[model samples]
Target chain A: MSPLSRRAFAGAALASLLVACGGPGTTTGSSTSPPPSVSEASVPPPAKSVAALGRSVPVGLKIPAIGVDTSVMQLGLAADGTVEVPPIAAHDRAGWYRHSPTPGQTGPSVILGHVTVGSYGDGVFRHLGELNRGDKVVARLENGKSAVFAVTAVQTVAKADFPTDEVYGDVDRPELRLITCGGPRTGDGYQDNVIVFATLST
Target chain B: MRRTGLSAMALACAAVLAGAVPAFADGTASPTPVPSRSAEPTKAPSPATSAEPTRAPSDDQVSVRPSGAPNTGEVTPSSGSATGGLIGGGAAAAIALGGGVFLVRRRRANGV
Candidate 1:
């Protein structure tokens, strides 16, 4: 096979393996299972970065425009401690469960989703990258409550400016932040995270 | 607290990935780690939130449903466009298995 055909086949196969490897994240819910529960008692003490919130809380996620939906799973800090991806594909609607902060609580309920995939044009969060200020950001917790937050601000930060505090900072009110790799694609992935900061609208 | 969370996150990541490595004994795991950019840091922020809210417990029912749930229509592969549903790691790697789309990625950016 030509290099182009070979690469295409390889990429498809690898993605399939990842699906089988991760598959409906034990933490993130897929269409098949009931949403997982997020009990503070079950979750370990907060570590650092969103990764420490080891349990996945989302049952299933949806976006209006793109037909992206996949299982949600809990992702722990990686071997190197970086936050894990949504375990499976479905980039158009793929999102990360901000494992630490509880939904409808005093802190920010953060989620990182994909804006676009390397090849797929309709990544789960592609429109997430298009969200304007005042757009609605909603999250349903495993406990069965859906908290709605309004987009307050949107910015693109280089991977270096993760804004650890700002994104997952201590806040007295319930807040939400949506983050994804943004800006020019660096041959491999995005160079920065497109951050959409939202606060509970009610 | 933020610094601490990042570190904990890294450790948790290690645990998660290590758990997956053995699973890869079946060679089920994909080889795309190096291909994607890192998405998180290595530290923590502060006091954690318990699942049981210290706040009004009764008002928490709204947490169950996601703001949006995936509708099958949005991500399905159509008649003309063959590759639509693939999301992050797994999907990308799946494509690699067939030796398809990603070949273009390598060529699109010779420097990458």
Candidate 2:
């Protein structure tokens, strides 16, 4: 075969590969890891040594499983009384809910992000739903300390059926919840929320 | 003649690399670091301490709760495609087109 022909063949073959695997998360362990199956076994008691950290406002977050590393902003109640979200333009960043306990202070610390940013593309949490059990999420606090948490569960539920209590209720140990829009998008916006439940691993 | 083949091979590799960069960028974070210090108990008491139910010192201390879950679904509008797709798809298309043009040029050169 002519040298030119070989080059053309190679180019075409690669283009085909790019198209076949271009979609995000298609080739990663984060998305392909199978969910753990439950069997008819008795549940074990909660870990008695669950550790809690001192109060320190989080300033940054990193989830190695999904390649999320960005500064965290504080989120407070919006004027309508709902919790405020980071500005749309700040789509790449996640926000920590100031009203909740600081990341390591006990109770459930809430963090939120967007799945997709308007015209800007995938937001910081676009791959969050792919987090499997035991994936680590690190939150860097203002005090120069970091709190690392591990995924316990990841659930997607309708916005109307959000598990507020399970998310915000007081817990016996420090926990974290990462939220983002998910499910089908409609006129009212995304119909469901992706929530990742994590407990302090360190 | 040998130089032409080298250039063509270089072009093909560059195009493929452009398309593959983003895919590889996704999981390039360095290994997770160990926390410098374990979570020490907070020395200061929460102002809302009274509202919290009584619990042993080992229990997670209760704190303020949000009135409700955040309404963040609209942070990204529904009408637009991500910029990433446009850039990535555009690069791949450009590379494919460039390759085709190169092949056609080579054929014409041989005919001459």
**Which candidate gets the maximum DockQ versus the true structure?**
2
Error of 2 at B92 (Å): 32
Q: Tell me the TM-score of each prediction against the true structure.
A: 0.44, 0.55
Residue B105 lDDT (model 2): 79
Candidate with maximal TM-score? 2
Candidate 2 C-alpha lDDT tens digits along A24-117: 3232333233223111122232365467888888999999999999999977655444667887774568998776777877778999998877
Where is the poorest 10-residue window by lDDT in model 2 chain B? B35-44
What local lDDT does model 2 show for residue B89?
A: 69
Off by over 4 Å in 2: A1-48, B1-64, B75-112
Predicted complex 1: CAPRI docking category: incorrect
Question: Please, what are the lDDT tens digits per residue for candidate 1 over residues A40-134?
Answer: 11112222222212222665554333343443444334334355455335443444444535445556665655565443554556666566555
Give each prediction's DockQ, rounded to 2 decimals.
0.06, 0.14
Docking class of 2: incorrect
Model 1 error, position A131 (Å): 1.0
lDDT of 1 by residue, B1-112 (tens): 9999999999999999999889886564455553343332222211221343342233332222122211111222331112223234546455554454455556565643
